[model samples]
Target: MISTPPPDWNSYVQSGIHQPNLPTIQEINKAEFAPNVIRLGTGELSPHLFPRERMKQIFHRLANLIDSLGYEEPKGLLFLREQLSKYLKTIGIEASSSTILIVSGALQALQLISISLLQRGSTIFLEKPSYLYSLHVFQSAGMRLFGLPLDENGVQTKMITKQKKRQNASLLYTIPSFHNPTGILMSEERRRELIDVCEQERLI
Candidate 1:
């Protein structure tokens, strides 16, 4: 099968699709580092929250797998995916190993998805005042971005139908846990509502 061309990727930004930011780096630095610091740009967990000991144990176990470290299949290790699938089961997501794809990070996953499905004129819906605005990956793939309004509970699900029709969005991007810019936690009801609406609209 033929592959997508890798050239002219930057041309999208050059065409002025760059996501505009609110302020300059100097302004952010001055405010963030002022002697009278108030709040951070975003919330983050302290080092204590990381599973360092568990990670160390995992690395120790994986040390023997060095011989198999060569580039593997695109779907990632089936064993790891199987383990993850079991873990996700406890959270009500009945996923199988076949559905799990381990990418380098969320950004790479987004890049791959955007390149695969988003056309030049297509749009994707995300939350207003979102972390996506700080990224150019979707825009770099020539996707128009749409911001859905959110409240204290989370994304305003009521507006989804209206905006989907207006923007003709094919995907909805979200960072539910510890949302980057605004840390508003999505409620369980809203989560279900989002799923229902997406299902009705046939959105990804």
Candidate 2:
């Protein structure tokens, strides 16, 4: 049998509307799957941390309980959303099940927000060294990301007002607790200030 050569992946990636993942991210994605490798600071949980037995039991239970494998509601399963609401309450977020939209994952949630909420040419304020920079979710949707400097507390709220007015920024994306890459947890005072700033500036 004759062999066929694979298409040029690099060309496809270059021509695509969505920007490619950062080189370091690409390396991390591939390296994490390699045998005997320990991935630290990556998005996914470690393999060793997975509850294999619990997952098996849950799957078995689900197999019996769930009669149909048909499509779920746009917001996802009701029970899951209810549970998430309860969980969020514990963390001081008073979200109702009706308000909650359960996405497949964080990336999907980001993509949904990027495309649905904001208009083209909208600006987003984010941490200077954010995980969002590695992904072009907002950028691909015709929005811009303006990075704010971070300190021990978290992203500098002081800069937000000026930047918001200057760039006409519409949204602020933050990982307050245990921020990605840097791992700088936002202080309670900082969180309050951020909320205040957002309210005053009318930034979401």
Alpha carbon lDDT of each predicted model: 0.79, 0.86
Model 1: colliding residue pairs:
none
lDDT of 1 by residue, 5-95 (tens): 7878566646764554446744775686576775446454545689999999999998987778677778998888999999999999999
Q: Over the stretch 107-165, how does candidate 2's per-residue lDDT look in tens digits?
A: 78888888888887888899989884434787778888889999999999989987888
lDDT of 2: 0.86
The 10-residue segment with the lowest total lDDT in model 1: 38-47
Of the candidates shown, which would achieve the greatest lDDT relative to the real structure?
Answer: 2
Enumerate residue pairs that collide in model 2: none
The TM-score leader among the candidates is: 2
Q: How much does candidate 1 score in TM-score?
A: 0.70
lDDT, model 2, position 65 = 79
